[model samples]
Target: MQQHNDTIDSAASADEPDQIHEPRLWRDKGWTARVIKNEDGEGWAVEMIRDGSAEPALVGPWTMGRNKVDPKPLDATAHQTLVKTASEVIRRHEQQLHAQLNKEVSIDFGDDVVSVRLTITPDEFEPFGTLIALNPLGDVLATTNVRPDFRLTRESAGRWAADGFGKIR
Candidate 1:
């Protein structure tokens, strides 16, 4: 096996069309795994970056070779594991963001149950939220715009319903 360094050679350029499989680098299945020296410690670390992304989605300590000096070589099994772990990290981040931007609640208004949903649109200048009320059958009852910081709770939703779904003050 050839000794490898952290930097990618010309043949393994990210822009190249062909996939690369090297001792320290593996680029395939839309992901690239690179073994690099750990800046914070004496050992080595591996980072998995998705294609077209500017940063690595996952980075962790790498195993040492039998010599206990050089880093272990990248192999098919290790590459697949790294890809799977990185993909999961991306998926979890997306789910957490979605939950933060969307909220929902159900409340009893008069003789019917109403479902209230608040969806927030984040912007650099002005962030806003939309509050929508739906009847038990999922028919739209009312819709209005509100500030992104608006808190949607059982008490607030009840008050909004009692006020005939007028503009929130």
Candidate 2:
């Protein structure tokens, strides 16, 4: 039933304070688990927030206590499970973002297979993309800047190579 008001101000450092283990809050291993009142309904909810992150990585309903009026106290097993799940959520998000920003395709051009890759850079004012073509031996044949919204597909890559790797229109 200890109390702690530690705020997530920055990434976990080597000199950070010792770990905290409370009934409703637990902080350790670069993650914090907090059981709070559920805003959507009557039951409680638990949130897992990683250090230095402004938002919770995962939030879900918490089990009710024996009396059915209070929330079950946070424990080590529960905290570990929450940490694993929240870490997975963050990992999936990163993978999805990477997939969205990068695309690749291989197509038969002339007598050889050419690998084409498009990487998008999301900038606030001037988002752009790079289109690269490589020979079967992984030698770069051409590279050019293109609109960020450019879509790289088998057909488009074939057309680009068929056009002699010129500017995409």
Candidate 3:
């Protein structure tokens, strides 16, 4: 916990809006990159931290220094690269979460077509989803709880619509 707090503090210090320094592996705006010895003591690892975050956003192997034992020193280019990589990692994770939590499909509803959405709420204790049917005007026609892993496939949506948007068996 102290290590986490220290990391957050380091990130916050580096992220001060007015501060600017030559690129280095240590810290950048709202982010910090630090290299540490691996647990096994056989290799080095780098940790990327975001300001105000109690956990590292990314962690990966680090290159050996000239001593062939110590970790390489952080530099401007390496810091920038690590920041970009960490940002991309965050972006991809968010995209994946969005994809898993929200899904929609169009289906024929009698004379008109409507849309159905399955939005999962991933709770560690009680995972669930809300299967919602929307009319042409975007008004919700129905809503019901479903398994957290429910998928909004075309066949399932069509069947649900046909069944008056109750259960998507």
Q: How far is candidate 2 from the true structure (C-alpha RMSD, Å)?
A: 6.2
- RMSD in Å for model 3: 8.2
Give one digit per residue, the lDDT tens place, for model 2 in 1-169. Answer: 1223233333343356756789999998899999999999799999999999999999999999999999999998999999999999999999999999999999988798889999999999999999999999999999989999998999988888888899986
Off by over 4 Å in 3: 1-25, 167-169
Please list the residue runs of candidate 1 whose C-alpha ends up more than 4 Å from where it truly belongs after superposition: 1-16
Q: What is the lDDT of residue 143 in candidate 3?
A: 89
* lDDT scores of the candidates, listed in order: 0.93, 0.91, 0.82
C-alpha TM-scores of all predictions: 0.87, 0.87, 0.74
Pairs in clash, predicted candidate 1: none
lDDT of 3 by residue, 36-96 (tens): 7777668899888887788888899999888897778888688889889988999999999
